[model samples]
Target: MALQNNEKFDIKIVYDKFEAALHEEDDIHLQFYLESFEELNKFFTLMGTVFGFVSKDLKAKMDILNEFLKDSNKSENFITVKKMIEYEKQNELLNKKGYTSGSRTLLRLHRGLDFIQLFLKKLGDLRDEESTSSACREAYDQTLAKHHPFVIRNGAKVAIYTLPTREILLKKVCGELDNIQKAMNLLPETLEVTAVVHTRIEKLYTVHDLHRLP
Candidate 1:
């Protein structure tokens, strides 16, 4: 990567914040730390965003993965890395819509964005326009327990996810095992996953890679 101009920039500030998030000494302290890192008072500003709208930390994480795959450069490696970025972006978009991570709850429920909002507004404004809303349309159903991550969460990440990459493909057959393990952490100590998961084995499978996870 190419370095920017000699104008001015401090790398330590971000480094400190990243380190702090990993080892949250105190809840209050962590709040202050994250804010401190973001506030202009604590760090410099730039014309462009430090991170993109989706998954601000992706580029940095990509760098790490790149180093790990430096010698390999296999297509699978790139596919895995690309899918990870896409997942992060999708999650970032979800966050923008006010969905909190790590939790399996919806605050705003089903909110139609500006496009739909504008259309409805225009319909109401028209002299002879009629509009109907199927807000009751359920985006989820019984499959939610397995497919929709909201019904079940795994530490701020989707218990299951879909992507067209080798990594996600692997995650599918493994039942997103890592996240499954984490989700298990949320279960009652006495409850067993095998008892319920097996009954819900009809997970949709169109493609092999992200089929089960999706």
Candidate 2:
């Protein structure tokens, strides 16, 4: 999609949808968001374009889950994150290798989301142009890097070096200089809300897993 006003990144829309999807703890409400995965994928692709190497694995994981959800026989049992986890467990769908279950796939994406949230938070908090790469690097190292292979981590560091300058990031996210401070201030709160949602979903998964254990 073409950038609006030649400056359209607008991560806020993605953040809004993510928040809404998280709030949908009810199966029916979660289904509504799942049905809109196409729109979400578009945003994901846009983010991948901006960040380059950071998003391909996430996109792949999303595709896997989306395909699984499209299966009529299996989709019904996966209306919510909790339900999806249960379905995977009950069906013995998760594997130790190759073709990991949708629940695990989504867990990977959740981890990536945490990294993205941190990166955006850092980007928003920046006060100078020179610090952009360092901010992204710091966020990546603190979050995603812990789980990533050494090669992947090194590649991500290289990608961070190529990130757009602070002015560009601010303009893309906030539209104009006047809006920057307001947008920046919102990032921390947004991260907090998303973290809560992620933790809740994770707890649900853990509880379900425990119930299934011998």
Candidate 3:
């Protein structure tokens, strides 16, 4: 995954995209949510090939959401997370066994977002000598790992070891700055905004009882 607009990786960009994703207090705009993930894909790409699975999964999920925006029948329903849930539930599309309903697809991305949020928070708290791999692994264990089976858990254990050192990881994500400290300072706001987006989506899922969609 190449950086969009040939741009450098910056935590501030991720922060802004996430903050832009929220609207009307509780509504989340799908386009901005995916755009934020596009910026996040760069973070995974910068880490190395070991994290390619993470990036590829996000790219695929983003493509699915983009398709919803393009489809004439579904586009209107997908403008906001709330609308997508209401529309999909009303139409009996949320649990059709194999159907790729917008609600179910976004739920996958929502889970991924949880992993990203936790990973970044851990990364931000690490000292210069701390292991980036440990942060990645811990974040995965707390979030995505619960949904993944044995094969993926084992694969992730190997893949996380390929992450660069804490200092280097900071350099890659905050590369736009001469001093990585500036970027580190942005993490709190970024995490807060992302938490709000995640919570909003989570509430929509709980309200509609769609958390168990498979």
Candidate 2 Cα errors over 4 Å, as ranges? 1-7, 23-50, 96-100, 128-130, 172-182, 185-189, 208-214
Per-model lDDT:
0.26, 0.62, 0.83
Please, what are the lDDT tens digits per residue for candidate 3 over residues 52-79?
A: 7788888888898999999997698898
lDDT of 2 at 28: 23
Ranking by lDDT: 3, 2, 1
Clashes of each: 2, 0, 0
Q: What is the C-alpha RMSD of each candidate to the true structure, in Å?
A: 23.0, 4.6, 2.0
TM-scores of the models, in the order given: 0.18, 0.74, 0.92
Top-lDDT structure, candidate number: 3
> What ranges in model 1 sit over 4 Å off?
1-3, 6-47, 50-55, 71-206, 211-214
Give the per-residue lDDT digits (tens) of candidate 2, residues 1-214.
Answer: 3333444344355556556666445322244343333333343344446455555666677677777678898777766787777777777776635556777777776677667667767776676565578888888888889888889788778877876777765655555676666656566766675566667755775676642321
Higher-lDDT candidate of 2 and 3: 3
Candidate 3 stretches with Cα past 4 Å from truth are 4-7, 176-179
For residue 64, what is the lDDT in candidate 1? 41
Query: 1-214 in candidate 1: lDDT tens per residue?
Result: 2224432223333334433433222111222223223421111122122112112232333334334335354323222322322443455532445532211111111011112122223323333222122111121122222332452323212211211232332233223456434423432321222112211211211121322221
